[model samples]
Target: MARAATATATATASCAPRLLRAALLLLLLVAATRRAAGAPVVSELRCQCLQTVQGIHQKNIQSVKVTPAGSHCAQTEVIATLKNGQKACLNPAAPMVKKMIDRMLNKGSTN
Candidate 1:
């Protein structure tokens, strides 16, 4: 009985290292696959503004959100929500939009 118990313990001990090695190998393969094939392969879509208007009246604009260029987009985006519950993309380079942004920025700074 003692010999049988000893044999079982030995078997379990030997299998433990094999099981642990297999698990470690699987983890390494999964990590390597993710590193090699995951990030760039998936399409990272950015830059929401496909088209932008040159101007919109200041009073008609309910809110404006300005997003600066970053990893998501190369150009600055100005999105305005109109009082009529419609959203419009404004061209950041446009003279009228630039003036409106400047005024809003100045007003914000003063407050």
Candidate 2:
């Protein structure tokens, strides 16, 4: 009985480090997943716009591209391409764009 108790204690001692290591590894994986989930994937916005004249004629504007130009600590540059292929920049540095990106990024976190 004494021998069995000693063997059991030694076995548990050996398992303790392994258990601790496993827990640490699991914690690291969870941290990594959380970080990855928070990271944003770059994307381009594509859409069409229409204008009506005389309440009858319809014009189709094809493929407006919205691209990210740069990212600062608090803001980013979003370039908006017009239907005529002209490009304009919408800066997150702007109050409206900043709020929009903030809301978008926040909404992203919930998913």
The candidate scoring highest on lDDT is 1
TM-score of each: 0.59, 0.36
Steric collisions counted per model: 0, 0
Candidate 2, residue 32: the lDDT equals 100
Candidate 1 displacement at residue 106 in angstroms: 0.8
Tell me the spans in candidate 2 whose CA falls farther than 4 Å from its real position. Answer: 39-111
Please give, for residues 59-104, the per-residue lDDT of candidate 1 as tens digits: 8999999989888899999999999999999999999998889999
Residues 14-99, model 2: lDDT tens digits: 99999999999999999999988876564423322222122111133232233343342222335444467654545435565555
lDDT of each: 0.92, 0.54
Best by TM-score: 1
Candidate 1 TM-score, C-alpha based: 0.59
